[model samples]
Target: MKLVVRVKLLPTPVQAAALEATLHACNQAATWAAGVAFEENARRPLELRKHAYAEVRVRWGLGAQAAQHAIKKSCDAYTTLKANLRNGRYGRPGTKRHARASGKPVVFRPEAAQPYDDRMLSWQHQARTVSIWTTAGRLKGVRFTGQAEQVEVLAAHRQGESDLVCQGGKWFLIATCEIPEGDLNTHPDGFLGVDLGIVNIAATSDGARHCGRRINRKREQDRKLRSKLQKKNTKSAKRRAKKYAGKEARRAKDINHKISKRIVAEAERTGRGIALETLTGIRERARLRKPQRTTLHSWPFAQLGSFIAYKAKRAGVPVVYVDPAYTSQECSKCHHIARGNRPAQAVFSCRVCGFVEHADHNASHNIAHRGWYVWVCGAQSTAPGLTLIA
Candidate 1:
């Protein structure tokens, strides 16, 4: 079990400039590589585009590793765009604008150049410090540290593993350390089920539920602010809009981290295996509904599930993803299935058997029951006090 923790880096103006320069250079290299591929495809063949990149890199004097990184990143972007074009995931490539249109083009940061031990530092000291290299000298300086910030070094990469990324600027790297996996302990008899939803962040079988808390309020406020900002069309309004957008993103991510930590702690206390719903093809299904589209899209189901899985693995607890079909519609008590079973959003009442419970709790119970079935089948362990409803 392994985890990567990210902390912020506070760089001096000079260091910031250098870092930005590196990013710009990488992006330029990627753009050039893409152009070469496109030109070669017109004259020769698409399959021979690799040679075009090699020729471009040589002309540009890019080092072997840097050129390789840039080419690979560009190729990946091209592949994704091609797939999206073929699958109709987005409007035809030329007709619609997407993130790649405005985003800083692909940038490569390889392990060899970004050494872990060489850059590692304590969060307290590192948060304020930036690394800068010049022709004649190097300098490090402390800038500012926010209340929620930390710093540390990340581990060097291993072959065949993609580097961990902090998308949307929510996380920063602090330091890297090696801890013994033996420190984690597991209990075979315990089991826990986690239910993810849009209204509530998560509900567990252990009688603990993490509400969305301020997320709904924040989203509403952000939406109103954005609408107001758009109407103004002033520089100050634009600045405010950017600031609020970043703040809202950070707030949501912080809440997610807290909820995930709480779930992991509960599993540790109960010594239980963790269970979750397998949410495959959920996004596609969500897109089909027009009225409930916002609510469906807002569900952080994947993020919550991923956080729980990694945290549980690090704690040496086994995690299972069971079939999610009918988990919400079926009655947890007698396995009765009907649309009328859930008379309302929050309240669940079984029409067939007259069983009533909270909708989330019922779903969680179903998930837990599924896990229990798996446990029983695998280990043949049964307790005297527990009763199987079916």
Candidate 2:
């Protein structure tokens, strides 16, 4: 499997200034390219071409490389936005609006270079070493190997939509790696089912539950801080606002990482397949629950699933996502469906069969059973009677 690990990049003051300068140039280029595209579309209404990079370079007085980078990035954004619109993923064309000054104005990607070679990127450097290059007498840090004191480059790639690096910044990267398919008949004896809930971070099939205590605490603290900041209309409040935003994001991500790691470790120990409910429309559904909206919004279900999937792939275990419709309401023992099956948030009781278990455990059992059924049928079988009783 192709895996990516991110590390930080530590550069000298001069190098930092150069990088910042490059970023500024890139941003200017983006602005220029956007303006050019807008003007061109208004005047002639033709498809924008890649040759605009040269025009931008000459018009903006930017270096050829910097101008090319900026135009390339801007073109990518335009293409993405256009595709999203065409696919009905967003609103109507020309109606879509973006703040002129908002969003990541500049992005850097060394991987976009043609002729992919592992040694060319900074991510390939050895420990305590860095690759540097000069364009127009300005030095830029390429990539660094090994752990640095303050910063590290976790991973870099050309195919990624955005350039991602791990530093004391407000961004994180999640990568998907493909591994060789495992033998289905050699399924693990144990199964782990994970249920994503608002109250609890995750409820697993193995009788282990991870509550959203830290996330709740962080959310409460952030709410209070935001309220206090709103009360004041000063520069300090604005500064505090930015810091709090970063803190809240970090807190959420940290909680997610911990929960995902714990789940992966648990599954790995048992060498079992991990099952999770397909939560595609959860956010939309949760929005209707006004009372539990905050908790629901804080649940990182997608992140947790992504973590479990990548971890499972690395461990040579299978991860399956089953339909979530009645996993919570159905009885694992008798396959009976009733509201009484879930008497409380944590308790599960079957009215028809008198089979009782933890609510999460019951759901997990259903998930595992569903995965097993899928495996045996050699397809995604949705028949309810296919569930096995244990």
Top-TM-score candidate index: 2
lDDT tens digits, residues 226-288, model 2? Answer: 998989968999887877666766666667768877887787777776777888888875434
Off by over 4 Å in 2: 1-4, 41-51, 59-65, 87-89, 92-124, 132-186, 287-289, 379-390
The 0-to-1 C-alpha lDDT of every candidate, in the order given, reads 0.58, 0.58
List the candidates' TM-scores in order: 0.71, 0.76
Over 1-390, each residue of candidate 1 has an lDDT whose tens digit, in order, gives 334434444555665555445445555666666665555542223343446556645664544444566566667766666677577665545654544542333334422122222322222243454443322234446343434322222323211222212333322333333323323343456568788876677888777878774677667777788899999989999887767766765666667768877987787777777778778888775444564566567656676677666656556666667777788789988999887888887888998889998888889988988876676566332111211110
lDDT of 2: 0.58
Provide the global lDDT of candidate 1 against the true structure: 0.58
True lDDT of residue 237, candidate 1: 95
Task: List residue ranges in candidate 1 displaced over 4 A.
Answer: 41-68, 79-88, 91-187, 284-292, 375-390
Model 1 weakest lDDT span, ten residues long: 381-390
